[model samples]
Target: MTTTAAAVAPKPTGSRTAALSFAGTLRSEWIKLRSLRSTVWCYGIVIAITVLFGILIAQTASATFASGGSLTQEDQQSYALLVSTLGIGFSQLVAAVLGVLVISGEYGTGMIRSTFTAVPKRLPALFAKAIVFGVVTFVVGLVSIFATALITAPMLPKSGITPDFGDSQFLLALVGGALYLALIGILSLAIGTIVRNSAGGIAASLGLVLVLPPVLQIIVAMTQAEWAQNLAMFLPDQAGGRLYAYAAEASVTGGVIVLDSLQGGLVMLAWVAVMFVIASVLLKRRDV
Candidate 1:
């Protein structure tokens, strides 16, 4: 028999992005995010926990201040912010878990292999997932914080902690708080991408976002070193929290904050950016 020319598939002719468009990746990611039951439940729980703790804090603050309980103006401001954000740390855990699950679940279930096959250039896929998830988190957090603020408004006035929603500074602080949560969500996604394991990602994320800040604080407390104590405020979570109050909080470092509220928000954003860059590089270099 005559030798026949072996058939070969045509190579992609366009740029990688043109050949494997991000629109498809973005659509697929959105679909995948919605399809997962855990996504719905975790978000639902996040919302519930946020509101539940807010109510409890409001009630507690109301009772504590009902008799015009010992309160200073400065303390009232702090307490107002605290009551409004009581569930932030708790909801952060839920958001962090969801972030880890979003990426790590694919690896855990062998879906990542299929994913990489569809889009050989992996970083776009990761970016698409992050953008979709980050936007969702930001929107949800904004709405939740707005609701919490309104719900706790009655209690705040009673506690002499009233913050005028119309006041730009107060409004900025509220917006900053929600933005902070959204950043945490994205940051956790970076952790998941880096680790490529569900539990490991979650644990690492919690450790970074929750445990490390306090541990730093403890170190400061134990050492009582001025430098060490002030350094604590520069950590991601602490720096982010600085944006949650109307006034610039005293530096843990005992130095004046040269940067304003917007700068503090930028600090948190910088942390997320660094993590994303690292995760993207690793995602590109590593095997699925």
Candidate 2:
């Protein structure tokens, strides 16, 4: 048979050569995020935990009040709504889990190879995931807090816990809880990008948030070092917690978070910015 060679065509130009826009990457990321079954589970778990825990706690308190228990102060009871929203603490773990999975799961499944191929400019992908996941987590956190507060508010009266919806602390706590979780999502996503293993990312993120604070506390106690406690205050979780706090209580570790909300938020963002830069640089330099 006579041999013939087929010539390869030149690549298409203009739009075909155009890089993916940041907005397009964001929308694509959002679609991928929402499609995951874990996304649904994480949000559901957080919201359910908030509402159910609030109800159960409120009922227990009502029983105690009926049996003659009383709060130490009237104002203490007014914080009942904010108290019910303590579910955010647990919800943060779920957010961290999801955030890690957002990037690391792709790596585990080898989908990240495809992702990097699609956008050779890798940093935009990271930014898109962070923004989209952050928004999701923030909305989930906000809804969880507000739903718990609404559901528990009426029942709180039976428990001798009066909740003032108009209370400044209450409002700030709700908004702050959402903002806090959103930042957690971003921080964990950055960590996930850095670690590139779902379990490792999850563990590192949680260890940073949950494990580090108590470790600092122990160190503070053992060494009687004021700096140890002060250091704990600047931790991502600790600083994020301030967003929902009624007061900026002093920590014994070296991270002593200031009383100012703006300062605490800035501190949290500072951590996010550092990790974000690290993740971005690594993503650019490393293999998919």
Candidate 3:
């Protein structure tokens, strides 16, 4: 009886095994992210889209110049910026979907129960997953966006679109494009956490990032209301789009709101912050 009691006895608080470090949790999440086939495919697609779009736009611009087209300096800058970041519009949808899958897949397969069981606190696992996903997504975005720029630069010189690598605005736009992608992915991850179902999460993610923008634009066009236009400017896609928009004189027309790159970035961060807080709260209070 005494031997059995001792064998089953709980260890003292100090002797209990230490909870897994955040670093360990991060490493585990990274492994899970990279091991998934969907992650591989989504990232591969992002790179491919960036390069292809760059090539297409570069060729189009070159041909136009060859046919006696002309552009002012501002137009040239805008055109170059467009070629560098146009892939962002298409790739962001993929990022949002991947973000949903990262968490929603675990929930679907019953793996989240195990993940929460291992972490016990739950929020750490959520944070770790977000951190890992955000970092990898950012790196992938950075590489693809910059690589496309370099690859397309030589194609543009014949058209008088010499890419000035030393241009601060140009560099910032490239970095901002990557940062926008990372934030978009994180925002979708938060939405997935809140929804907790793969289909619903993806639909909601894409709906916010994709559908809502166009719908709101239509409303603004039909109504021409200042409020509608201003509200549209705050949507995730609208604000994030400004991140890579060619820098120009900051001006607002007719009481409508216009966000500079920095303001746009802050608005996007606010969206992410609000969504993440909600997700963290729900993940903690709800049952896995």
Candidate 4:
């Protein structure tokens, strides 16, 4: 029989045909991040430093008050801000080291080969890792800051330092501190991805974040050069430091440049953006 047979087509299976989504990549990255013991230790150290330092500062201020030392309202606010944010200076280094370890560890262990293989278009993995790490870091930083504030709030009253929680500037300082930590971590991650070695990544990250600022300060002190001072203001640490600075007034005076929170944030974002671009390009071109 020469009957025409109906055309038949194979239906695609959902599992085989489904593409790897960014959300799926993010979830995978998050799984890897949370599974690491280093992540737990680093985050623990961050929280401990923040809370413990806040306690120490609050106690010191309380003792001062008990000994009859006094501060004006502005000074009190300054002290409160310091208590809440003092740990950020130290915590940032920890966060940076953690950031480096996150990527460099993968490379060190050769898991990056598998990582890239799973996601043939490698940039998505890089971005997924960055986004996952950055968001977690920001949340952790925020929690640590707010926890310190809450723990120290009662103690501050003993120092005649009552914090106005509703004040916009005070709230901004707290939020800014967290934001700075996130950016610093992401910047370190970009550095780590480019370097692709744990020790080298750490050294490079610290050189830029820790060593450069003080070196520039020393040069400024030696020469009192206006350009040197202005240049230092744009360095990552210096610019990021302004983000958490409370009630920093914009200087209209010549030879004095002060970055408000927004200015500092933009500058720090620029630093991260530039490094990330370089890292992305290298990651795409380099062999795993």
Q: Output the number of the TM-score-best candidate.
A: 3
TM accuracy, model 2: 0.86
Model 2: residues with Cα > 4 Å off, grouped in runs:
1-15, 63-74, 247-258
Q: Which parts of model 3 are misplaced by more than 4 Å?
A: 1-16
- The local distance difference test score of model 2 is 0.81
TM per candidate comes to 0.85, 0.86, 0.93, 0.92
Between the candidate structures 3 and 4, which one is better when assessed by TM-score?
3
In order of TM-score, best first, we have: 3, 4, 2, 1
Highest lDDT, which number? 3
**Comparison by lDDT, 3 against 4, better one:** 3
Query: Deviation in angstroms for 21 in model 3?
Result: 0.7
| Lowest lDDT block of 10, candidate 4 | 10-19
Model 3: lowest-lDDT 10 consecutive positions? 1-10
**Inter-residue clash pairs, candidate 3:** none
Ranking by lDDT: 3, 4, 2, 1
Give the TM-score comparing model 1 with the true structure, all chains together.
0.85
Error of 3 at 235 (Å): 0.6
Per-residue lDDT of model 2, residues 37-101, tens digit only: 99999889988888888778777767767556556543554457456667777888888888899
